[model samples]
Target: MGKENSSVLPVLQWLNRVVSEPHYLLHFLTFFSYFVIRCSATHILAPHLIHHLLQREIQTLLVFAVLALIKGVREETWEAFIADALFLAKICIFVLAFTMDRRLAIWYVLVFLVMHMLTQQPPFQGLGTSSKLTPLQLESLLTEGNTTRLWLVEFCASYSSGCIRSSQQFPELSITYSSKILSFGIVDLGLFPNAAEKFGISLSGCMGQLPTYILFDNATEVARFPELDFETTFFHPTVTKGLLSRHFDLDRSLLEYFNVK
Candidate 1:
């Protein structure tokens, strides 16, 4: 028994070390930024062209900063200086834009300010799409044995069809999915279980699944899932039931999509 306990200690120690490493910290920052930008773009800037441009500019700055860090290892000082200068330029441009146009600026500034404030705070650390669990949240969830809730919350918040396009532009801010028990269960069973059923796959204990499996791997295969099709299926009577029943104040475009009267 003592020998077994001693053997397990190093594994436990390694786990702790990996969890507390800097890479995890960077991952958290990346995901949080992506989540904030997505939410902001959908809610605040969807209709406005200028707001969209501003968001794109900020996103561009972030990309360069991340690239600098990745390439900086070989050319440390030069890369670091370039990254820092780009960051400072980003801030100055934002400030100048705000000062020049208060009305349009307010919308963009609010989004930028909120993200900046959130990033600076330690409590907001590691709160991202990748790991549904912040350190404290994970500890509590583990103690309570409520792993299912964690997966549900993350899926509802982070899983989006549009996120893939956005992540392509900003690789550092991409949300990664690891092959964990809870994540596999949610992706396989909860999000698109119907599709999986069609594929003759069981929901239990599946391994090495990728996100592309949730949707058909190609556009040709995608056409088969009628319910997944936004244009034709989204307006179906059965689909509109929930939206109409809840009496959501959606616009004409959205109402038309739901086939709501």
Candidate 2:
């Protein structure tokens, strides 16, 4: 058990580093490997299987085309759910490509590269920055000297579609409501999965809960959103800026911050 954990830690750490900070050398290696993969696939698959794989790629493109058409039908109609769907579709395509066919996987990488260059935005990379908290900083602030303040910390993973959907909302809340007495922060579960164990969050995909919002008062968790529902089994009402405000009473917190003397 000790050896198993010892081996897993480095792999998770490396992934955290890559996602938090891009390494150009890794990109270069991946790019060079693309051609090698293409050559290998060319020899590995027969003519019929190659045709079938090509069809699969085309079907994937067609699905995106339909989604694009829907979004293009109206300019203002674009919503978070649509973006979420597109993101999830991209993830599905990514996983299926790697599992079903190598050449298709390389094809996705190429297309994603071009798309990323065009948009200057990539998936798995979060939208904006926030009052990000490391585990140590969080512990010190919550448990150490100061015991009068209130903190609303969002525990989230960068890779979670839910987190990506609500990324901008938390920062905007922090800007509008954050003061000396009350603060807003973000702890990326993707970067520090170890924090999940400490915070009592499950990293399992089956849980379907990545972005958990907790309101901490004087080192204790006073309130939380999407409070576990055993009947339905997940946090409901969908996380939004409005939801956060109401769930934690941000207006009251703001008023209290001003009243602090």
Candidate 3:
């Protein structure tokens, strides 16, 4: 039992590290191996079976083409279908690469950027910056210490996607509410291990999970949100506002501020 546990522990730790940080080389090698295996499968398959499969797929395409022509498909409809087909093809490529070789998929995706870059533009320009808080600063703002009525502090890391998303929202949130009513602070866990340790937050546990939001009402924790919640809610202003509003008695005026009816 001890031997088995010891063997599994190292593998688990290795997996934890690999998942916690991005490794392009690891992804590339994995994908390349899968790609080679897939290529080898073609050589192993009987030529007769491959030919039969190709014929069947061609027939299916012809049937779809005929049906489209009979339906009087407009130019726009054809364009839309073509766009969807291209998107599906791209997804198939990404899936193949992601499953076997992720590094290639990440690079190959640049091919589609031309289309997206030509079509889309960013919606928001970002509002401003969130305040930075150190251990002493944070301790001073706790419930027992002199602090505002409501405070929200984000324990974040530079590498965390959720943290970056939350940071984008922080500027807007702080700007709308102002520091008097509701304030925002950020403590980078990587830079300040003591802060994370002092707050009983495990850095290893926080590797892939970050942007832990702790809402304090004069130092007493009113509400806390974990990484999973941020993953789902960070991108949606309405959903995020709803969560905060319910727990923190956030002003209804924020709805107007965000143009959410």
**Which candidate comes out best when scored by TM-score?**
2
Off by over 4 Å in 1: 1-27, 54-261
Q: Compose the digit string of candidate 3's lDDT tens values, residues 11-92.
A: 5754554444334224434435545655774676588755664564456456556655544353222223333343444555
lDDT of 2 at 188: 84
Candidate 2 displacement at residue 130 in angstroms: 3.9
Alpha carbon lDDT at 26, candidate 2: 42
Estimated TM-score per prediction? 0.20, 0.55, 0.44
Per-prediction CA RMSD (Å): 21.5, 12.3, 17.0
Model 2, 1-261: lDDT tens per residue?
A: 999998688467545554554432344344455456656777787888777767766776677677767654532212344454446465556755675576777787787676555432223333233468898889888886654388889898866656655566677677778777787778888899999998877777557666788898888998886576654235365566777899889899888777774
Q: What is the lDDT, from 0 to 100, of the residue 211 in candidate 2?
A: 77
Best by lDDT: 2
Q: Give the local distance difference test score of model 2.
A: 0.67
* lDDT of model 3 at position 236: 30
Report the number of backbone clashes for model 1: 0
> What is the lDDT for 131 in model 1?
39
As a whole number from 0 to 100, the lDDT of residue 55 in candidate 2 is 78
